[model samples]
Target: MTLRILILLGALSAFGPLAIDLYLPAFPALAQAFGTDIEHVQLTLAAYFVGLAIGQLIYGPLIDRFGRRGPLLIGVVLFSLSSLACALVPDLDWMVAARFIQALGGCVGMVAARTVVRDLCDPTTTAKVFSQLVLVMGVAPILAPVLGGVLLAAFGWPSMFIVLALFGSVCGLAVWRWLPETYPADMPRRPLGGALANYGRLLRDSSFVGNALAGGFAMGGMFAYIAGSPFVYIELYEVSTQHYAWLFGLNAAGFILLAQVNAALMRLRGPQFWLMRWVWVHFASGMALLAVALAQPAALWPLLLPLFCSIASLGCIMPNATACALARHGANAGSASALLGSLQFSIAAVTSAMVGALHDGSSVPLAGVIAVCALLALALTVWTASRD
Candidate 1:
């Protein structure tokens, strides 16, 4: 049963990254296709993030009110249709809009999967399962770009969208055919009023906000990497896009491996202890990386080493921080999971956009954003821990 849930959760979580990364190699092709600049091509990514952030919030309430199956099935249907539209679009504006809708649809799988996990398990189990899910997510970004490059090379930018559409359809069918409704009958049934009340209570709890923010900043630190990596690797080091895919995959593997370590630790110590330690790990890794980046003589080795350490930091923080947040509202899993997931992506999108806006195509901007985010996250984690 845990394996079944893990597979479904992984597939659902992978949707967001797969949707973005699978088409990344086509950035130049897309810019050319629409007669736009590179910056405009990046807007497509930002728009998708915005849609994902908003969609998770909406899906949470609907799932709680109507049950997971209905809202989830509807989301996959919309996701598939929007993906088809993305493939067929004639211009960049059309592509961006379609991508937004696709993200909106795709986020349902993620929100539902998290809510479902909370419904079925206790906090310890939630952290462990979420660790396994991250392993699967780590795979998508690793392989998607390679696959995207091949698709773009053989056919065109649109072909990648076709592949993604097919992926969504397969996932949708799996959910409809096999996934069970996990909401228990005895669990407190909540409508909008009840959901609002729960949210109010969670908002008043500092530990919930603090832990969620720790994870949120970890995400923001990651965005600094995402916004800057292509330039740092491809432009500065002159690595080929195909090679960059492999490089990117290696970093993701680091995330996967470390998350498993967190899962193993959870079997003994509390999630809070692991989360507090990881927050410091994240802060130290970021500062070390930033120091090396700023002291650079423009060597590739200096960049990759610290960057991997910085990414590995998340492997420790993400699952534990999330476990703490969702642990607070076990009774209202769907709504709580929704707000938690929504806040994560919303902060991520905003931070990623900030990195984009402050971009000068240099390593400093990326490292600076990471340091600030990590430091703030560490402080909040400490504060959250002491009170708890």
Candidate 2:
């Protein structure tokens, strides 16, 4: 792919992560502003995940039927509008509602970007391209918190939403001008029933379902971290907002670095081989994380170390599993990508909400949730591989 294509796709994929991570540093401020607990503030993240999960199902058929560009433009415009709505919200409930609306629009970019990759590239090439996309997506987490911290310090949390609105507007304009419609206009448009049948067929495929579950559960652990870290780092560890952003950036850097390593390894080993191997690593790291949280909750390093390893492993697992799943159903790439994204975000949403709901003013909820997700992911991968 050309640099321009890579950049556009990367920017498109980064929108969700940017939206999620950018507001993290402001969580404490948001909770303060709304006279609510941190958990209630965290629900906003869960709301976004819920939007992403459901909205992809709606957009998948639309993209496949009408082609990619039209659905993408509509989604971005909606995202920008909802972002503005979020900025204008007067309370936590309205903020959560606005976030859901924002996610509904923002999720289109993720599904479309993955679908476009499948449309343009073979499976092997798709894995590499996804890794490249990860490199681009990595910038969001690294910059978002730092920028959010700065913005929160300067202009408060509402300014972050305004910036997101501007970002959505710019991305929408870029998609309009530059992103080529990968789905052919002449392609047959399937009826809604046909699209539902396609999803049902994908659900029945062991390889696709297995990889999707594996990826989704692995991502659930990451979402648990996202939901719990603000409390752990800020309240428990007493880190400053700037310091927390740096710590978050450090983990994100590891994730990006390992993603590049996965891309290089893809040149030498297949995605399945690496995916199976990393699932084991992810499981071990999760166990280690739980052990440390149980044994040394007071020491920050013990927990942070294992958490970093687990998240880094996820960076390897996601793109490979995604490529593997999409590779199996090239005939229905849009539906496949949509299902994959929906499952992942759904798992993430559940875990994030659970972490918040189960918050005990300690690290156990976070560590325990991560361990459970890892074991489940590992079991699914093993079961799927055994079936093969």
Candidate 3:
């Protein structure tokens, strides 16, 4: 892919992270605005996760049958409209619903971006391409919260959604004017009824199942961090919202840095090799985080070290796991990418809800959840390696 195409696809893939991170700094403000608790505010994030999980499944078949560009453009339109709705919502319940709708629309970019990579790149190059995409997409996590905090200070929380709406519109225009339909017109289309059977086949493929779940569980841990960090930083550590973004961005920078390293190292190591190695790193970091959280240390640095490591490990883990899973599914790239995304978001939704439900004004819940997820991912990675 050309640099222009790669950047555009990366931006498309970033839609989810941008939406999730941009309003994180406003969680406290949102709770105050709606006369609710942080738990209720967290429901908005969970709702978005749920919408992402369901929408990927729906879009997978549509993209496979119809084509990538059309479904993608339509989804962006829906996302832009839903973002506008989120900006105008009268209450928390309405906000939650709007966020869900926005996810339903925004998730199309994720499914299409991965499928496009599968269409254009071979397995050897897939991991590198994904890492490169991460280099571009990673900018969202690093910048979204900082921008959100600024918007919150200047124009209040609703402006974040307005900005997201405009972003979606720009993405739509980019797709319409520049993105070519990567899905081959000559490739035979599967009957919509067969999507389930296709999914079943993928599930039964041990390599695919193992890698997908390994990656899914790792992603789950990241979502746990995302869902819990605002409370941990702002409330427990007493960091201001603006400063919180810098901390969040620091972790993202680590993630991006490691991803670029993985891409460069790909010439010497296979994706599974890196994936297997990093899951261990992630598990170790997660355990340390849990231990520190259990100790209830007075200082934040003790917790931050392991937290950053665990989050950063995913930089190597995700692209490798995804490339490995999709390597053999070229003909069914759309469906495969969809199922992979769906499973990841489903686990993310669960982890997000878990963090909210288990909130007790402490860091242990988040730390514990990340630890468990890392353990599960480790097990799945081992299983995937055994299959190889």
Top candidate (lDDT): 3
lDDT of each: 0.82, 0.91, 0.95
Error of 3 at 358 (Å): 1.3
Model 3 regions more than 4 Å off: none
Whose lDDT is higher: candidate 1's or candidate 2's?
2
**Cα lDDT of model 1 by residue, 23-67, tens digit:** 877776887889986667777887888898888878877888888
Question: How many clashing residue pairs are found in candidate 1?
Answer: 0
Write the residue-wise lDDT of candidate 3 on 336-357 in tens digits. 9999999999999999999989
Model 2 per-residue lDDT tens digits across residues 145-236: 99999999999999999999999999998998988888745567656668888899989999899999999999999989998999999998
For model 1, the superposed segments whose C-alpha errors exceed 4 Å read 193-195
In model 2, residue pairs whose N, Cα or C atoms come closer than 3 Å (at least 3 residues apart or on different chains), thus clashing, are none
Pick the winner on lDDT between candidates 2 and 3.
3
Clashing pairs in 3: none
CA error at residue 18 for candidate 1, angstroms:
0.7
